[model samples]
Target chain A: MNMNFLLLLLDGLKGTVILSLLTFLVGGTAGFIVALSRLSPFAPLRIAAQLWTQVVQGIPLLVIMGIVYFGPAIYGIFAVPPLIAATIAMAIWASAYLGEIWYGCLRSVNKPQWEAAECLGLTRWQRMSRVILPQALRLAIPPTVGFMVIIVKNTSISSLVVGYAELSYNAKVINNSSFEPFLYFGLAGLFYFLVCYPLSVQARALERKLNVANR
Target chain B: MSPIVEMRELRKSFGAVDVLKGVTFDVERGQVAAIIGQSGSGKSTALRCIDHLEKINGGELTVCGHALHTDKPDLAALRKDVGIVFQGYNLFPHLTVGQNITMAPKLVHRRSRKEADEIGREMIAKVGLADRWDYYPEQLSGGQQQRVAIARSLAMQPKLMLFDEVTSALDPKLTGEVLRVMEKLASEGMTMILVTHEMQFARNVADKVIYMRDGRVHEMGGPEILSQPSTPELADFVNEEF
Candidate 1:
């Protein structure tokens, strides 16, 4: 591709990175809360968190973006900025999957650890933060990194309907005028592979290292 | 002072199964009581109830002046006064031995870092693992990890300590080392309750020996009762143990 084509793609990559980071920050925080809620002693909170996961997983990321992007304007009410709308949809979607993944990690830490923490007079918060989370976080790294790869790729779908100016969106616009679909889209595909393949490799490495420790 | 622990007809049920049926026992301060029984005899369940790890379904339970039979006992306060170690060791796998020993002191007791470090060192030394303070739980053998678990409990400075089949998981060599730490603690006059299969250790170290059968105290007396035949069931039980 030409320098101009390369620059446009670089700009799109920046949008994707920013979206992915924001999604991880916002959605990762929510996912932690949801994971805690899933294990919460209160039945209602546990049930509500379960419902949230079920409902979100039932809807695709594209549909979620459409609902957040268009559902607001369809009401002809308060308008959301495209970036904000995309972040909100992508974050909500990530929280459900991340929460479920994290809940499994949390539960996998072993039952006696909970009892031991409790017998030590640790407050529930201390028990979670100090004792349980440290172990769970180890098991969570691989799956969480794997999920982020999914998040980076899914940010592309956000541009299709939400008009977020991400990599594929920019490539499509450039290809429409230039009529060089293969060159531009191919380059966009390579950029995604560059960003995502490392994460997958890292996830695999962490899984192996941690499973050995666990054994 | 009154007994450090008093269970007046304490009853605990897991659904339709009554694990502890109207069990009553008392452990005075500085007394090491050994609870010896078969797998289903509820020795472990009784020890668990003393710390309120398992809720009692019927009767009164009091530990370190905290009555636990009620709906809401001050668990934080009760736990501050009681410590329990499980057979699994249950050491926080990610933390170093020093961190595992210091966690409760720092978090629950809110000891400063310097003070917590001091406590961690002292407790680990008591378990004869002073040099391994920086090592992770996984780095230690089963016996060493169990020793670290004991040190973790000791850092809390509880009024009572409970050991639920602590040495049951270790080999004979490892079990001896762990039991030595426990024997040292008993000599120091720690108020302790242990559920153990080690009949010899029970006879030598325990001030009181309780024999449970069918989720009830079938026979109870001094350590000598282990050698003496008070009941046919206990006689048979002790014979089988030997």
Candidate 2:
């Protein structure tokens, strides 16, 4: 309810946005590589990508943040900033899941499209870039936008483990000072909704547009 | 001149079941050969092998002077020379009809956008779909989509074309429209191999008719073979409605 506290939360919202955007930029690039590796003809590359997704999916993000933030200290390198650690941890975690999502999208493209491209004598790279990826990208947009909402929400997990001053962390600080869990947490939830609801709505709109086009 | 496609004792198997057993055939330049047979008789499989869609277990296949029997065949070169159309008309659903037609020419053939677009328009006009060039595959009817697919293949200017039951999924009117396109292609002296159930079209348009039985060429000759009883298998196949 306090204006100062509201400003504090707004400042924290900035941190959340920065962290989510940075994590997605890093994660999305890695995720694209992971998705292509999962579909790679080379056996070892596919296995390595599969193992990465499995390991990251198996571990909780809180644990990953802890390891990323603290594990380097045990190796005598303690200068790792909380923001950098959290970003690295979140990028790794997000890439695994995003990679899996996109892998499914790439595979969802009909097999005949691949055959058609091959019969046209397109090389492997040409087939993927020109024929296959263009189609897969269309199928991927709705889910990829939907996943951004998850990424934004998941940034809060860094506050719990890495002590990153994101929205949830600032809310906790406010609650500690005011001893008002209801007021602070409620405002935090509101801030999250403000950021994520638009993404969810946009994702749905894209899905409908794609379906109509397909029809 | 060497044939566009030459297969001698070509054999293919799916696990333990042999689909094309020692199938031998040759398609000369500008010739349309129709391969007809019952289901599981390897007509489609043989057509597919020419495109390297199916790997052969034994024997020889040479298409456009590239030997396909080798472990590392020049598949890109082979495919550049061969264009294949399936019964499903597997056009890229996301791209416009013009984009679909120009994809291979622009990417594989390295044609400039203007050149590809010119060929796209030419092929679209050839298929009588000039008005629908900008439309998506989902917007077109099945027959129109199939014709766009034919134009897509033609844009590559392939030396030989393969059709695998391209009209099997079409209604009678749609089939007639697609068959008419093929007849037009044949009249233009495009080299083609078609695996078809349309006996009448084979009789009328195909320069050579190869009747396959259990993966071997049971009888092969000109269109006259359709009426003559050179073999009982051919006679039975001709009399029966596929």
Candidate 3:
């Protein structure tokens, strides 16, 4: 309820930061691969990527975390750490959503743009890297930053069932012992806002810049 | 050498809608063949087929010595010898006029940055936009964008160039600017096929005019054919344009 509780919550802050960063890096890469697959010329890759997006999106985040926590143990792969399990579930969750968001962005590029790139004799990857992705990246920044906020907040869900000692988890434990839910939880919310507000501002600034350039 | 492009009954369909039904034509090297037609006459579709943009469902299409009829045509090689400009002026919006022209050249030809910049400046100058190298597509007027688009294609130095109504989206003055650049390319003897509504430009510049009607070449002959049409459909079409 005192300085000790504040210090303990700060210790928990370390895990949340690490978990969020790892999740973003891992998920962003996987999501990009998934988005490309969705747009792949090969039919099977496109179908499989479509299926992955649908199935992952349909499941609840809590269940996904639970499955990651216990699903492996059923197959004799036990002792997966809470943090690692949470990271996997979070990544899987973020990939499907980000993949869909980005696929829409990429496809939104004008059809003639694709034809123009192809007609220029660029290899497939060259067209993507030099033309399409640069344009799509502009459309993607706002939603992607918005999703990072979701990712930060979603880390709290991991603590509920998987027992990961992230920010919200330690705050909950401290409040349980001291019976001071208002101050600790309020402080936790403040920390969450502090982490996410700068990202939102940057996204808005980038979006404005892109719009002005487009204008 | 064989003709730069030979289309014998080339066919294309989109979900039971036959866009190019047995379309046939030939374009010789250094020949400017203007394809004039209405919206549904499949001129753009046919132009796109030369670069394997749209697969021909039946018959033969050969461009720059590559047969385009096969299931797995070497599109990369074919495209290397071909460049296309679209009605929408599909210049990469994120890139400056200079970069838009130089990007493919740098990637495909692997030229040094200095050489690429030289190519960019030269091509941009050829298109009469030498001063606007740093301008982005959105910054340019439609006509200017179309000119930049032409310059982008010209930088590739393709054996054949296809313009699918390059000036269709521009105002008369802007279209004139774009047409002037294209006229310079024609004067330079670049083999070109253009699907255009500009009957006057076609009459003046095209060596051969293919007046397409209903996905078929209704009339084909020298530029003189534009003034004296052999078919009622072409005469009507040309009359409407004038």
Candidate 4:
């Protein structure tokens, strides 16, 4: 095996970083809408959001990626790029979980906050934008940030379905050629740790800050 | 001047339980009425019903001659005319004192930032917290936060204020501070409906005192009624350990 392990590792690390960043950016925004939709006044909107979350949670990530990669073609649209398919799949997954996380925070806002805003002559939209969302976002920050680390880590699975050249995919390719499972996998795990640990720490620190602010 | 709010035969229930039954009251312009009651006597529910926060199962509610029970009772207009100070102070913790005061004015009144800021600063000064405008709710003492909550409500220029046990959650010293602001408001002729157990403050600040018992108005009269302490039920209940 004349493979360069270091080159494979570098390439994989880049994939991990790119995929995680893209997923976080796109996924976070989509998740916000899902969260708000789950709380919508329209019963159909609420049910749609709820069903979307349940369906995403039930399906395996690999199957979802496959569906995303292929489903767009049935409509005769442009061929969904492998990276785009993986990102969309990851975003769907993230929206479900993040929506649930934020819905919990939004509900945690004491009932009086809603009543107080209502008495202040605010419409439902005004109550949400002015009174409720500001408070909910504070409670949501820590958990949302924490869930982002999961989003980052899950990007590794994009390698399984799309065979995207993410760190995990590169490591598997390198190990198959060189037969050095321990070294290649260990390096891949190290790269994952390097990317995720700081985020985990920041999430925890933000959680502490939220607690203090709430207290 | 006309009565600003009137609730006639108001009735509300939740499933098998009745929270308020055939409750009747009127709040006249520039009059402060204090409603005192034991826990679960429907004082809070009545106040919520007035705000349409809880729709009455049956009865007529009118605010400034406009009916409150209609399908669309001009909610924004009604709420604009009525402000509330909650038991928990409920100041938006994420916002500074100034922002909290200015929020509804800017959002509901569509006041410009400059105008709202000026009003917020002026009210903060009135509440004796001009220096604390930039501070967050958590940074202030409970009393100070409650004062800011009052100022926030005042910024809306409400025709009536509903205070639900505003000082119940505060320390004794803090309660005094909050009551002082309220007393000042009452003196300034702001119509207010307050739910409280502070016998002294109610007697001193209110033009009328209402006692609620078992989801109904048990008694209503001048401040002298509370001072004399007539009913055995009232005396027993007030003295009982909660």
What is candidate 2's lDDT per residue for B164-217, written digit by digit as tens? 999999999999999999999999989989999998999899999999999899
Native-structure RMSD, model 3:
1.5
Best by DockQ: 3
Clash pairs, candidate 4, are none
True contacts kept of each: 0.97, 1.00, 1.00, 0.90
Q: On a 0 to 1 TM-score scale, where does candidate 1 land against the true structure?
A: 0.97
Off by over 4 Å in 2: none
Question: DockQ numbers for every candidate?
Answer: 0.90, 0.84, 0.90, 0.73
User: What TM-score does chain B of candidate 4 reach?
Assistant: 0.95
Candidate 1 stretches greater than 4 Å from native: none
Native-structure RMSD, model 4: 2.6
Question: Per-residue CA lDDT of candidate 3, range B1-242, in tens?
Answer: 78999899988999899988898888999999999988899888899888888878999988998988987898888888998889998889888999899998899988889998998899988988999999878888999998898889888888999999888788899989899998989999999999999999999999999988888888999999989998888888888999
Poorest 10 consecutive residues by lDDT, candidate 4 chain B: B233-242
Candidate 4: list runs displaced more than 4 Å.
A1-5, A71-78, B227-242
Candidate 4 iRMSD, 1 decimal: 1.3
Estimate how well candidate 2 is docked, as a DockQ score. 0.84
Top candidate when judged by TM-score against the true structure: 1
State which candidate, 3 or 4, has the greater TM-score: 3
TM-score of each: 0.97, 0.97, 0.96, 0.92
CA displacement after TM-score superposition, residue B168 of candidate 1 (Å)? 0.5
Model 3 lDDT tens row, A86-122: 9999999999999999999999998888888988888
Give each prediction's root-mean-square deviation over alpha carbons. 1.3, 1.4, 1.5, 2.6
Model 1 Cα lDDT, one tens digit per residue, A1-215: 57888899999999999999999999999999999999999999999999999999999999999999999898998688889999999999999999999999999888899999999999998889988898899989999999999999999998888888899899998998889989999999999999999999999999999899988
Rank by DockQ, descending?
3, 1, 2, 4
